[model samples]
Target: MRQTLSNPPSGKKTIKQRFLKLLPCCRSDSTSPIIQNSVDDDFELSTVCYRPEGLDKLMQVTKFDKRELQILYRSFKSECPSGAVDEETFKLIYSQFFPQGDSSNYAHFLFEAFDKQKNGAVSFDDFVTSLSIILRGSVTDRLSWAFNLYDLNKDGCITKEEMTSIIKSIYDMMGTYTYPCIRDDAPKEHVESFFQKMDMNKDGVVTMEEFLASCQKDENIMQSMHLFENIL
Candidate 1:
């Protein structure tokens, strides 16, 4: 996986495209309201095999056996009181982990990924599976997730406009404390550098293949992707 950054072999599917195929199959519509003030009761009730089929599938994807899954679900339900966590709630909760409570951009992208159904909220199932990937998935899995985060339009590619927008949002999330007090032109410069290395064919757009290739070869990028690991 650490060869030169280049187009994947023809006929070999990009990880991002393959991941997109799996996304539809993985989504769940579990809208059961969170049992507030009943964590113990919820644990007891869960022992009876509620949503056995769904739980089975979740375990299959997450590799978290019954006990671990139950523990995570209990924790998730405790935080998401309404059975689902809305973006605002997620942002607020996620921000608390940051030194300045300024994780808005990262949290926004993470919430978007976890909200698999694009329904403006994250269900318990959604929370568990996505967290599993972030916590334990392989590098390829993490890269696919990163690509999904940057491909804001869901069009299977990243455009210059999207890169600029995302970078701007990240800077905005940093508030006034963003170091170096970078110039106004910094975002464009960053976007240009990204395209220079990642666009491959200079088509003014970056396909998932290119993004994966570039990131895979860059040790710093790979390391940075796991920056939140300790906090998590």
Candidate 2:
């Protein structure tokens, strides 16, 4: 049987209980009910069809016209069951459902959503929580996402030089086609500094073991590595 993006509802179980266990891979405020509610609310809002009369209104959600709804349904029907939503998929959905220069993209929404207190940037905690909210896949999928960041050389082992390349690839994937868009968020000096962090053993290069150790504590990361090895 194909998997649904979300597990089928176990009748009679409360949403609170469900929410408590949903994102096992994340380190969220398990005690704060408000954070939990905000994440859920944002997710529900995203699923609605959004219409806009102008760029300023692009972010507002609205009712979908019958014809527009049909197109949305047919388009989604074309996808395979294994192709459930992910950050990349969400971006496409937003673009098709609501279009207005970058307003239709997930990046802008994500940046704005996580920029709490009206700060232009997001805290690491906020960013990770939001990502966990969007990515429902288990630990394995999360690991794949991280590995996908570092395995830019695609040779499996990540050396220092390859580490820098991987960071650059991540920025490129985020929709910046420039040579080094990572420099936008991270200074060129800071971007290069990631190699220092990854080179944990200080042997001048990093092996899979070293990289895994740094992120191994994250169950999501390990699950991905396990799945990756099995696939290979």
Candidate 3:
């Protein structure tokens, strides 16, 4: 039987909980500073307070509360003292959770998804924004983000090659941990199955509309989404 979102497997953490726990504890004594500035001239000026860059904006945009943001920020700072994560550090951090698997390729894709700025680095704003959507956004939101990830070339459509690459990378990352042992042709088969459903016009490419419609109608795929949540 397929698992349902309502009934996650026993002892497995929800994506949000798992990510929170995975964050390394903050070891630094320094706190993120709050800036305050005042200027007085002929006219009186009111005091302005500036919280850490993007902190307030993130709170407004994401599901995380102030306390949760504090925890995440502290952890992010601890791991990435320079206030940003490069691809190499990202792969290293991802490898820790799946020690039995080769997480490099999957990590590369994930980092690209999170690097919204396309600057070869992921800032805290980019990190938390993606996390919030995956962990707590509406189904449409999550699916849209997944679509963007699969699009690869930002072409607004998903080709079979792009989907195949994604599936193969996932299988390679899962390695020996997958039960029943994946076959050599498993990635190809998986891609075929998805294309069969998602390529609505038989044009060899899946548009975002086709992708979203098919995914929502497919109960099994929706349930399986939780299984891959740990990849983030």
Identify the leading candidate in terms of lDDT: 3
Q: Kindly provide the TM-score of model 1 when superposed on the true structure, using C-alpha atoms.
A: 0.70
Put down candidate 2 lDDT per residue, 28-85, tens digits, no spaces.
Answer: 4665432354666446435645234421221122133333332232333344133234
Total backbone clashes of model 1?
0
Would you list the C-alpha lDDT of every candidate in the order shown?
0.65, 0.39, 0.72
- Number of the predicted model whose TM-score against the real structure is largest: 3
Better of 1 and 2 by lDDT: 1
| Cα shift from native, residue 188, model 2 (Å) | 3.4
Q: After superposition, which runs of candidate 1 have C-alpha atoms over 4 Å from their true positions?
A: 1-49, 95-106, 224-232
Query: For model 1, how does the per-residue alpha-carbon lDDT over 1-232 read when each residue is reduced to its tens digit?
Result: 0121123334544333332232222223342222233576556646644477988888888856666666566555556657798999878766644434256876787678788999999997887777677646888887787778778878999999888877666555444443455468877887887788788989989998888888799886666444333223
State candidate 3's TM-score.
0.79
Query: Cα lDDT for residue 187, model 3?
Result: 80
Residues 161-232, candidate 3, lDDT per residue (tens digit)?
998888788777666655566689878887888888789899999999998888899887766544456556
Candidate 1: pairs in clash: none
